[model samples]
Target: MMIRIRSRDGLERVSVDNPAATVAELKFAIESQLRVPVHAQILSTNQNLLLAKAPGDLNKFTDMLDPNARVSALGISHGSIVFLAYEGERTVAGPAFHPSGSFGKKMTMDDLIAKQMRITRQENPHCELVSFDRDAANAFQHYVNESLAFAVKRGGFMYGTVSEEGKVEVDFIYEPPQQGTEDNLILLRDPEEEKFVEAIALGLQMRKVGFIFTQTISQDKKDYTMSNAEVLQAVELHAEGDLKEWVTAVVKLEVNEDGGADVHFEAFQMSDMCVRLFKEGWFETEVKGEIDPKLSRMKKDVVVGGKDVTSVDNDFFLVVVKIFDHQGPLATTFPVENRRIPVSPGALRSHLDRSRNLPFVKRISDFHLLLFLSKYLDVNSDVPALSGCVRAQATVPEGYQLLIESMASAC
Candidate 1:
């Protein structure tokens, strides 16, 4: 279809190829063809609003759009879009008026608490598989209460999708361990790791919460290690079929009676060496030594030992991602620029994208992300504290943050 619109100044024509293309794509196409930044871009769809000045925050400006990540091909949920007006107070470059004659919904405190893009709502094909689990509401967000300093978890164990009632639904969902399917486990990479880390940081600061997860898939529970060193060498462990299932043994840790912790690790005795090497960070240590590269290489050989594994083989563990009760809070007052109705800063939006807007708004318009945390798990535990930017905005250095500890955490 060819589209031609006569503006007050002149005539404009555009050709459509993929009707399936979303408003986001159309806007991008127009921007690309016209060589204009989305900030000043004018788009008339269901309703109109200025495109937000932030990248990674697409939902705000194109809530009704189809989020198709061609590069990664991950389509975004349409309801995730939000209308963005360039200025914190208003949009001055909107020549196209919205049919609804309004600027869409205004963001609220609850929205901030939910860390939702008020402008965007999840689209209709909302995956009916997602049923509500009232039992775990916001339970997964509790991890944000950790001391507001730099912290990262291997993975998140808890979180729920945005609920229809506008509340966040948290849950401890489980999936059977893959007997031997590599595709069954979608392992995350560094960018995804950073994405979670950023969300964790913001959730702790703004929502007083985030998540930690360990899918059985995320762990390698293949019993590769053995209590007997001789067994590891004598028994060649290989699956019989072209699709071999490597069963890696795994273990959990507990705080022992003597105040020291007893880490009961599972796996072949050969792997014991590596697990021991992993201990320094989780405890309170400032510095760490690098493991000899030779050690890692040698260990891989010992495990594979010519095991005819398939083309795809990675670690998987069906551990839990849990959000503990927060011992902190999100900042109520961080600075925000009111230059326009939505004067979103690029840095701030980038952070939200990095965090996937995890049910908390730590920094809005270069503002702060805030959440409420009890220094203890509850009032019975202790006074509620705050984390992230709240601590940063405190006496701590601008680039640094103070800390807070939760009474109950890392479950």
Candidate 2:
């Protein structure tokens, strides 16, 4: 069985053969797999433990204190996600950086640092409007609101189309492996899984259009719409995407006049200035508690509202985009990917059986379901062929249908 471990670093998995393994054994596995020393590590089922400010505060969480306690006794099992807090410097590997020659001219690193882009606010967003597929939006929100109870942050990549009028329509959301705390969201991206997603999107004639994330309940009381960390993450992705119309969507719970919690969605495009600053390495990435969450700290003073300052308000970097909804072509009923519960082969069989009365293409008109099949079938050929058939709503080849049914029965 595989158990997920989420820490400040990110989400990772460890395997154990026995379901009845002790908590001590689980810690040992974590130590070996994650490389945090057993003694320095503090494990808990409560996600709030990761928010502890001081070493003294950690004692309040006693959920996983007993080493001898059986993992199953504590309601942990395969696909269960546990929280981890550790003390000390744990090295996380980062991508290798290779600087390019300065436009074929020889310049010292010191000279390059003197020529960073000046920060500015953008009055208008490149994206005029952003629309969501009703079912896809509902599915993404329902899990975070009900199952997770808005206690932690969550994020996914929005996949769909961008129009010549600068309108962005999100048909689906592809969630990557990630760990979220009350204040932080760490996306542990998988290149292999993304390749499958890209292939399916290609067959469907769609592309990745935006990024979406949910804020925790704790963040509701904050003064700002987005924190500095959030601005950094959003802008980084915006820069990487290189899409002038790329949108960033936020999902949150707000209290209404009757004291009822309502799910609200807002869309924005990181201001052109924000993306430029992020790409040019002008914003400070390290977050400290002393710094205000509403403002982003900069490496040097930048002009904002005609004043030079070391920090800029996060709101200054966000340009609101209008929101709308539409009924997309694909269905979102199949179970979402990368949630706590594993999507088993039985799910495939059940889905096939439930939709048997419909056309073969209609039976498999789900992005997540296609994603599942993509893992087993050839990404370069078979995945695209199946997705192409679904896109056209054409009759599936008999041999392909037989192959799919055989896969479902193998469960």
Candidate 3:
């Protein structure tokens, strides 16, 4: 029997020979097979337990605290998923998979050719079109342009709806904590804050649709549409999103014919082959300084235009998607999150005061505002309740109004 274990690294399986294994036996097996020490392991049936940060936090989950408990009694059977947490890092061994010519066998030319990966342009993207809410789009670009001056990279996740026709409508952009340099963007994701964002989106009938990023001015001089680093980052996120229509949008400053700089937006979907290569661990994620920016390095040689090579042109992995703008239902008057300057309660008070003439529901319709309130309100109840009112354009309950006002005034 095999039990799947999900941790920060990814999912791996631990084999158990016994049908009725004890919790102690299961932990022993994990220790021997996965190379994680039994004393350092923290097991839980709840996936959220993996997000626990401290010893005090881990104590809250008592599902697998008793080692004497029987695996069957705990409802852990073959193929059941068990979440894991540990004190330090371990090199997680993935499932057994061998590349071509690795089985102590000599391969014929035809066999090698058959294994060769061919790069071709994807003519059409799965995402038919992507429409951004005018205000939401403006708010994002305005900040990067005005504040950052497009000198450093910045990124965010697009949240909105997808229509039956495969068209994506982006209503908001949630910027996670990140460090951006002139050439690289690193996202420092917050799982706790993301949970609140998810809850708010759930109540407002929306979801994460795509990824958005800005290119620095130094990158504008480059010839490639997207650098190798950018391609790797975008494809990884697209694969993780698991949405066929997921879009990757780039914001940059382009020199117009008038010799003035203009903010430009372009969208693309990673080609199917690109996502497959990323998931299959073919692309070399580590960006070497000597590597060309226009090409992506693969661990093995792949056929590019009938020639075997370790580097493939970045353009081959991109499928352009059409972009449009629309007036969405949500507002963008509230301060955004994950910015250099933290959002304060005074900003919330100012937002409420500025919109005093508007209805309570209208005042709280913005996604940023909802995100702010989500930090204080109950995600399971208060968040959905308030977002539901905004969705239906219904009246905000007096209780919620008072609570929000009190929170705004508390600071």
Candidate 4:
């Protein structure tokens, strides 16, 4: 008989009969499954994100002498609301709403794991999200070596399996990937797309901008109105090649503070907005933006000769310009910042290699930055090398400027 374990994503059955299996063993197993490392996990019963914890007893942390670890609330109904238990902060059981704000809906598998990430900060320390998927009960049995490979490379393993009860959960040692390894988070930016999403959000914000997200824009003002057709038109136009005048100016959104974040956009500014988005890494970001004054007119991306071309606009909504111009004048390089695992230099070199620009580094900014950097540095760094001098800092390199957490770190 195997020892049954419940994790954040689900539950699992470990084969080790000895309840005294080291925490290190459990961590290793968790790491292999979840892709988190052994060191980044904590043993806290609190649920706080963006904060650090006092270190645990290394021996206790590394050893799994206590077989019955309260890792998670697996084997339960999967719901949109997460029941978060906090110790130092709230010290009570409260509802944790899903980031998407959809209540009582089943999240995608990715969202399900991401949900744990928030709770992982405080409630569940021994958990992580990995890049692979397998039969809930047999991921470990199938990908043990692969899990170890990720453990050695990107970070630690983040794997999990379901219990005999069939709940969706994950288990892993919360090893944070190495800091500053893969750091470049992307954003989504298509004038039409942005307009549609923004319009929907605006509708939500004012009870006047509403097509999706269920949150209605609180404003009942007749001055503001949005419809799916008008929104779709702008997107269609962008997909075609009609509007292309780029306006790269910083539109301030507020005052009483000297910060540069009060940014908003209109359809006329969509071209530059799109550029800003591309620079920010919204290669394939889902369409999101308020409805243009004329959304029904927007077009979808035009594909000619098997290539894609898009138009830009401004009337879509407000485009708050952040970084007008910088010295490097490069677009974003790394899409998101990722942490690495603990491994000697050579053990995971191959894993790191995959992240490198394949087939001569695409991304218009990389091309320009490499050229720009080369003009100041060397030529060889242009093609298959990471120029030591030039870094394609994103226009919005950090996550969201207006928001507390910008995708910048993740980007």
Judged by lDDT, which candidate is best?
3
Worst 10 residues of 4 by lDDT: 206-215
Clashing residue pair totals per candidate (backbone < 3 A): 75, 0, 0, 117
Which candidate gets the maximum TM-score versus the true structure?
Answer: 3
Name the regions of candidate 1 deviating beyond 4 angstroms.
1-183, 188-211, 214-272, 276-326, 330-388, 392-411
**What overall lDDT goes with each candidate model?**
0.27, 0.86, 0.88, 0.27
Q: Where does candidate 4 stray beyond 4 Å?
A: 1-226, 242-411
* By lDDT: ranked, best first: 3, 2, 1, 4
Error of 2 at 279 (Å): 0.7
- lDDT tens digits, residues 238-326, model 1? 11111111122222333578965332322211122223222311111211134221112221111122231211111211111222222
Candidate 1, run of 10 with poorest lDDT = 310-319
Question: Which model is ahead, 2 or 3, in terms of TM-score?
Answer: 3
In candidate 4, position 166 carries an lDDT of 24
Q: Residues 79-114, candidate 4, lDDT per residue (tens digit)?
A: 112121112211111123233444333345444333
Q: How close is candidate 2 to the true structure, as a TM-score?
A: 0.72
Task: Report the C-alpha displacement of residue 285, candidate 2, in angstroms.
Answer: 0.8
Model 1: how far residue 287 lies from native, Å: 33
Residue pairs with colliding backbones in model 2 are none
lDDT of 3 by residue, 86-156 (tens): 77766544334223424333334344333445678999998789999999999999999999999999999
